[model samples]
Target: MPSAGIPGWSVIIPAYNEARRLPAYLDEVVAYFEGLDRSYEVLVVDDGSSDGTATHVLEAQAGHPAVTLHRLAVNHGKGFAVRAGMLAARGELRLMADADGATPIGELKRLEAAILAGADIAVGSRALRDPSVTRQVRLHRKLSGEVFNFLVRRLGLPDVADTQCGFKLFRAEVATVLFGELETIGFGFDVELLLLAQRRGYRVTEVAVNWADQPGSKVTVFRDGPHMVRQILAARRRLARRPSASS
Candidate 1:
């Protein structure tokens, strides 16, 4: 139960086989807002982890009622897990962050401030010149990420950099609308969600945030890259066939 005070934010973390990381992430989030006067909820979508991730969450529930756990019966992709959590959140602002906490939870105030400034969506961007974090990632990962972004730009979501950043905040209303219409169930689902928001006349702002690449990520370089390319092409074609927001 939350404090009987104000309606606050929801942080949804979609986790899959991340038992090692979930405890630390939960602790960090809990400690980050320990003194804040607002309410904050953390939803962990355990996408069918065989590594006992859900059990760990359940065990941790003795002290953290604000932390909720949603278990998927099987291993769905990150997109599916995130969709489940966002749609289930009950806050004015809903944020889906990585389970590994790559982007520090402390920077959430910027995203919340963006929402207060009338932005419908706020996403983290590693491509910005001044970032809050700059270590822990392998150079090859950065190179491949740039290559993917170059290809993704061809789909016409301009002025948007680093679509792959796992930390993002959205107005709950906008999140409901966009996540409801999302079709992709994989990593490229982030791109699809952004494309849908852009088409709906939503004001999306990219905030330059600190990001530390965490080890033990589920993404495999060779396998996920080709699949992401296919998803981008599919998203482009789908958006091309639909009418724009003004229509």
Candidate 2:
């Protein structure tokens, strides 16, 4: 259980059956934040994973007081899980990260700096300046990602280079507002989140970070690709209809 005060940072991981890969990341998060001497909490939203993902987080909580678990009764998409964690977080700064740790946890310093420098949201970008570290995906996956970015730009958000990157940081107020209004409950949720943030006049910036393509990704070009496109289009329409908040 968290104390009454807000933590300095809240790390929210939307996990769905990531039992094998999640523990290492948890260890890293615990070690890194503890060493930094900042008050922090780690929330693992288990999206109804049957593979004992909740159990692992529970065990982690036993070892670390900063760790917590939220279990959904049924498997929801990544977007829903992330939304759950983001809305429930009690940190001054909230970060939503992939359970696979595609972007190393240490890269958070870059994002924290951006937010402190006046950006309301700082998102990880694989397309920005190169990093000493690189992640390799299949050639076809790489091509498909390019195509998806093209569609994302055409659909609405032209300024964002990579909308699907799984690492993003937000101020607590920003996270609560955007996520509270989220409509997409799937992979396209990131795109929608950024678009809404822009519409609300929030400063959003992309920061290049070390990223690697982890195995066991949930996205597939053939099956999920088309669904994601539909979600994007729907998000655009939904946002267009939404009354903008006063700047």
Candidate 3:
């Protein structure tokens, strides 16, 4: 169990119609965290899936008390689900991982180490190569990622190499502050979060971790891509006008 005010770690997964894929990842996360010397909690925020995603999460709860489920009445975007879970999490360290388990659960250690070393946020970066990632992504996906990262660098956060990695860890206080103030409710939330972190003068680090592109992903490059680009540009302008802490 966690000490008085904090769990050792909180794992938050924002799942949208992930019934077929979420179950196994849940088991893997539970098993991995349970063996650690400290206490942790796993919260799955179901983004109003018509499929049995919520039901599956509830079933997993019966066996694992640390596992919790939060259901949205309608399909809010991934941003909404992740923000809700991040605010609700009670861990000293909060991590957001994709339901697809593209990055292995075992890779949490790398992010955790980065935070322990003083980064307020630690993001998993596929751009940085590591032996852990066994499968390389398809050409189109790789191209899109490079394009997106380039935009993220030019228009928004120049320091972060990969904004959409789906794997990030934040100190509880930092996560709460950033997510509480978030305005984006779509795939671009990752960019917005980092933008907020940079605005707040928080240190963010990128670490390489194992990742495998999974099938049945919800993102459509042609559809969501342009929207995400707009979001980053809009957020940058919005943040620039806001008064900073130093102001």
Model 1: per-residue Cα lDDT over 31-97, one tens digit each: 7756687787888999989998988788766577778899899987988899999998888888899
Indicate the residue-level lDDT of 97 in model 2. 93
In model 1, the Cα lDDT at residue 92 comes to 82
After superposition, candidate 3 runs with Cα above 4 Å error: 1-5, 131-135
Q: Write the per-residue lDDT of candidate 2 for residues 150-198, one digit (tens) a residue.
A: 8888887788888888899999999999999898999889988988898
Error of 1 at 71 (Å): 0.4
lDDT comparing candidate 2 with the true structure: 0.89
lDDT of each: 0.84, 0.89, 0.89
Comparing 1 with 3 on TM-score, the higher-scoring candidate is: 3
lDDT of 3 by residue, 1-247 (tens): 4234567889999999999999999999999977888888999999989999999999999888889999899998999999999999999899999999999999999999999999999999989867756656878999999999998898868888889999999999899899988988999999998888888899999999888999898888899999999887888788888888430
* Predictions: Cα RMSD each: 1.9, 1.6, 1.7
Model 2 residue 183 lDDT score: 82
Ranking by TM-score: 2, 3, 1
Model 2 poorest ten-residue lDDT run: 129-138
**Clashing residue pairs, backbone N/CA/C < 3 A, model 1:** 133-210
Give the C-alpha miss distance for residue 80 in model 2, angstroms: 0.5
